[model samples]
Target: MAPRPPQQKVVTLTDPKAIRALAHPARQRVIDELYGGSVLTATEAARLCGLTPSAMSYHLRALEKWGIVVRDEAGEDARERPWRAAAKDLRIDHSGHGAATTAATRAFAATFVAPLVEELLAWAGSDRRGQLDGTSMSRGRMWLTTEEAKALVDQVVALMAPYEERTAADHPEGAAQFSSFWSLMRRPEGSAAD
Candidate 1:
């Protein structure tokens, strides 16, 4: 068979309505499931998410309406339609709106973070401690100038570029899913030192 087409990378949110559509949890779950190059039917997705088939179908439709996912016509079965994510990265520009925008952005961030938290917890609980053993983990407060802060963010983004490019390939079989979560928050000027 011919190779599958490369997945599209999210550039910008041209439509605010699409962003709003993805604000729902169930729809976000659908997006996450289809992220790692998985083409799944609504029934299959529902079973994975522990939801009724009809309910999962509804969310899948919402995702399709938002241009976040597309249906695969190659699948022969009409009863089970395969779906894939529309983009590899979800880009949301928060420079426009006020309070509502902030809330929406937070909701979007939470949608992605929740799954990672669960996965990390599961890994910690597993008997195979070797995976996490000898791992280097660090958490601390840092004080940096405005320019320095921007440089730090750029460095982190550059570090993750290679891994992001790998998932774009057609990996049909089971493979390890790795994710790196980076968060940076700076205090206002004159804030108390730690």
Candidate 2:
């Protein structure tokens, strides 16, 4: 038999309605749970987000309509249906939207990212001797032309392929999932600090 096709890893959301729907705090939490490889039922998502099952069902339906998540047939039965993330990453372009979309996008990102930021800070504050080895965070700034910026993103995405392809079974002993967050952008005018 032929080799299986590679999965679509990133999905771009261009509709403002869809973006707004995804900006809900509880919905983002449900998406997070699914993205972390848990095939979750509405009840499970509800529990994770501290919402009623009916409420989570509504949010999951909205997410499903936007193609952010899909039913996992393999993990479902008559009693319950499970949902999984449609892709490994979701992208929203904020270039041309008005204040509302920008605000919604910011709300979505802030709610989604706050936990990760807290996690990093906790890791940083822990005693080095008792903390996990080989974990790190780095920051830098550089000026580049628009074309060069696009090329840099392309290169990094290519580098991520191998790590993205691995399954839980492929993970080595003592290995755990690591979250890598990156931000690249032009400095705003009148910025004083580098």
Candidate 3:
């Protein structure tokens, strides 16, 4: 399963600075690992992301400043503790307007959404997709009032909440990690909600 918030706290970020900080490709990769059940020290994360320890420390600090990640409790000797994702889910609210914000928002979208698209394309072209039993590719649109849309998203979130607390070891046999992304967005030529 994809990363789910342990406490069902899906952080909605409207701060451009925070978004910008998170949009770095290496930082986003590190965040994915942390969220996906890796509690990593700076050195470990650096090795995972192909950065030097100091450079990883810089990225980790930027994420820490935004509360996107936090250091776990220290060892007995006060060595650099491992870091974990502060939230399982992150939503970027791109309601801000400005050139810098626009750039940041674009970068954020690329970092998060590109992998989904790439994975889907690869799956579609491969024989493995035919062997899979539970893969899902769903897309549809509805004319929902804004309030109704919010309610729909809430229901979906609630559906996911129970899975949040499960660990890899707790998973049943034959279970595999899944990657998915969902979005509800208006079409560019969309009319006002009915």
Candidate 4:
């Protein structure tokens, strides 16, 4: 049978609390697993993250409280229910929300990018270039009006959103999960943070 199309959707987070809650690394591990279409029990997630099952269960409950993950039906065992990612994507849009929201969004962005950065560091320190073939680093500089930047970003997101939601089973043979990170910033007069 042919692979199915992605069930593309995004849950946009504006609540500062939710954004902060999701900044936890353990929770992100669960999100990544679920994003790859693996419905997991807390124990399974714990195993994947090298945490105790009880600790993992606590993290799962926290995510469930925020509606970031939902419980699926029990499989063969009546006691172990699986969890699924609430949506294909979880996005942060705290702009214009004030200081707390801004801080939470900053933390979320850092948390989201940290693991990918570690992967880059790993590649840099390793000699597994052949094993990691097709991995790449890209850089580009562009000058565009604010409106044009927003439009371009929206277009890119729209184009990739569907692909981002594809499940492990939806991929071809020998497929692996690929991590990606991108940032767009304008050149600032004095501040490099821009």
Candidate 5:
């Protein structure tokens, strides 16, 4: 037998129910556990997330139904089935969905985004935060043609590809997770309704 790859390439979510299901804190933890191609049984996941096994099982089942997680066929057991994330990362596009879905997406985003803000604040307050850590953040406005904006995003993703493909074996020591967030949107001003 051979080993599976370290990660699945990607999974995109457009279904509102799936997005809403993922919005819950506990389920988000479950998804995080399975990131980077890791697999875990409900019991193991529950322990990590501080949830009861049954509660974790319920969340896993919901994720499974949404195709966000799947039974780890190689590790499946009659006693306790294991699961893995369907992709190394998820891409969500709800622009095609209606207002309710947009609202749900906002709520889902807050679940993760708010924590990132707090984490940044905590790090900034701590002595361990070093100026040379390569962490950078910024906000600015740009005037660009639609084509130009698309090209900018493509360049950003290209720059991130190598880092995103890394595995623990690549570093072998002191490896850690890093996060980045970006969005490019047109201002609501000057629109017809406005």
Candidate 6:
């Protein structure tokens, strides 16, 4: 296969309301399932996640209220309302959420990270583990001016763009769901010259 193109940074909402809306585990799973090209009814989604139909319905309603998922009007069944994700990818702006992290936010982050760790372990057990062969994994200190830091982030984002776009479609039949979490943090202790 040919190489994928660079990704475009597309983060629609930078508001606390949107971030809080997606903080729930059930809602996040709904987003994941729908993003995989499955416009499913409440019952179908509930079965997929082992949730009760009524519980799934409540979560679906919450997602709809937040404009993250929308009813699939193109479907024919009136009793069964199918839904799809509003965006193919979501980027949460943590800047305005406030300095102090709430228990709810921390819990949500832990829930999200747990599944990711599980998947990485499972992936390592499989034969395709060699796919990470050429990939580099390391941490190091860096000193960069404001412009240089921004440019570096842009470059990394660009490189990951195409893979992000094709992530859902690239999975084979009966493949387990995989989640990718990308984050960049800057500490105050380090100066630009550091």
| The best candidate in terms of TM-score | 3
Predicted candidate 1 versus true structure: per-residue lDDT over 1-194, tens digit per residue: 22243357763564556566676667767776676556778888898888999999998998888677878765657767678777766566656666666666666767767876886787678886566544444567897887998899779867866665555344346655655556677765687874
lDDT of 5 by residue, 92-165 (tens): 76676598788779889888677578778988898868766667778878888889988997797778777765
Candidate 2: residue 68 Cα off by (Å): 0.9
Per-residue lDDT tens digits for candidate 6, residues 5-105, read 21322435555555566676677777777754456789988988789999999889887776667777545557786776666555555555464335445
Query: Per-residue lDDT for 1-194 in model 4, tens only?
Result: 22222244777777898888888788888888886667888899999999999999999888878778787767788798878877777676656568888888788878888788889888888887557477888887787998999999889888877667667667677867777676676666775544
Question: Candidate 4: what lDDT?
Answer: 0.78
Would you give me the overall lDDT of model 6? 0.65
CA lDDT for candidate 3? 0.78
**List of clashing residue pairs for candidate 6:** 7-161
lDDT of each: 0.69, 0.75, 0.78, 0.78, 0.76, 0.65
Superior candidate under TM-score, 1 versus 2: 2
Between candidates 1 and 3, the one scoring higher on lDDT is 3
What digit string (tens of lDDT, one per residue) describes model 2 on residues 19-75?
Answer: 778767788778766765567789989999999999999999999898888877644
Cα deviation of 145, candidate 4, in Å:
3.2
In angstroms, give how far residue 162 of model 5 lies from its true place: 2.6
Where does model 2 exceed 4 Å of error? 1-7, 74-76, 125-132
Clashes of each: 0, 0, 0, 0, 0, 1
TM-score order of candidates, top first:
3, 4, 2, 5, 1, 6
